[model samples]
Target: MRFPCPDLDPPYYAVIFTSRRTPGDGGYDAMGERMEALAREQPGYLGIESVRAADGHGITVSYWRDLESIRAWRQHEEHRAAQARGRADWYEAYEVRVCRVEREHGFDRQRA
Candidate 1:
């Protein structure tokens, strides 16, 4: 899915990952796709957005059903390994923010 954000209010968790990517590597693309696929298979994974900028900085925000789900994702072995690779190879710098989304709203237009 391109985006996975929802328009509901019942308390959800958001994992905001901001990163500056390293130069010349295909590893990040593979790992990112793997993570997205893996996340969909995990319970409580609502959705995610992987956004990048022209200067190599980007943000990936993933929504979850609860804090427990976020924690489980954090402790996932494959995720941990990917995190390590991110630090060692893919990312020049990165920061993660975990927050509670108490409210949300959005709209979409469809052409007939």
Candidate 2:
């Protein structure tokens, strides 16, 4: 099970991936897990939060230390393979946005 990511400091970068799945699991679960694990190992990776609805809509936001780190993740060999598979199999439609976070504030009951 996935939980909300811990609040991170501001001035970081966030890559938001919004997607609509094609249909069925189609091995998406395994690939998605692998990608998340690989991302955690990359330099400058901070955290990630993801969720999907029963209707196959989903969003995943990955936090990074800087633009360079984001770019490196985009070009990662394994990530590229996953992207290709996503285009060919997993996602029916998707959009990506990269933004610099200038401020952040949140409350977590567990943390408090």
Candidate 3:
């Protein structure tokens, strides 16, 4: 689902992760894809947007239903293992930001 942020309020939590990549890690792409797939299967996963720069900085914004779901995802063993690998090999650095989105509005072109 694609979420277009319009006149949105702030109360819903947003998980924003920004990372800097390491060299020669072809596996990171595959691992990222797998992680995204897995996340969609998890509870409270709303949606995600992933962007990458030519300089190797990447940002992923994942939307969740609540704080508990975010906490659950953070403590998930599989995610923990991947995060460790990211810190050890794939990513040079990362920052996680959690914020609340109070309200949102969007119109689906397809719906019209």
Most TM-score-accurate candidate:
2
lDDT of 3 by residue, 1-112 (tens): 2334333234667899998888776688788888889888889887787888888898888888799999999998888999988988988889999988887666788777
The C-alpha stretches of model 1 lying farther than 4 A from their native spots are: 4-9
lDDT tens string, model 2, 1-112?
Answer: 3657776888999999999999888899999999999999999999999989999999999999999999999999999999999999999999999999999887877679
lDDT of 1 by residue, 1-112 (tens): 2564545465888899999999876687888899999998899898888778878999899989998899999999999999999888888899999999887766677522
TM-score for each prediction?
Answer: 0.89, 0.94, 0.82
Task: Arrange candidates, best lDDT first.
Answer: 2, 1, 3
Against the hidden true structure, what lDDT does model 2 obtain?
0.93
Q: How far is 94's C-alpha from truth in model 2 (Å)?
A: 0.1
What is the overall TM-score of model 2 with all chains considered together? 0.94
Scored against the true structure, residue 62 in model 1 reaches a CA lDDT of: 91
- What does candidate 3 score on TM? 0.82
Report the Cα lDDT for residue 74, model 3: 93
Tell me, what's the RMSD of every candidate?
Answer: 2.2, 1.1, 3.5
lDDT of candidate 1 vs native?
A: 0.86
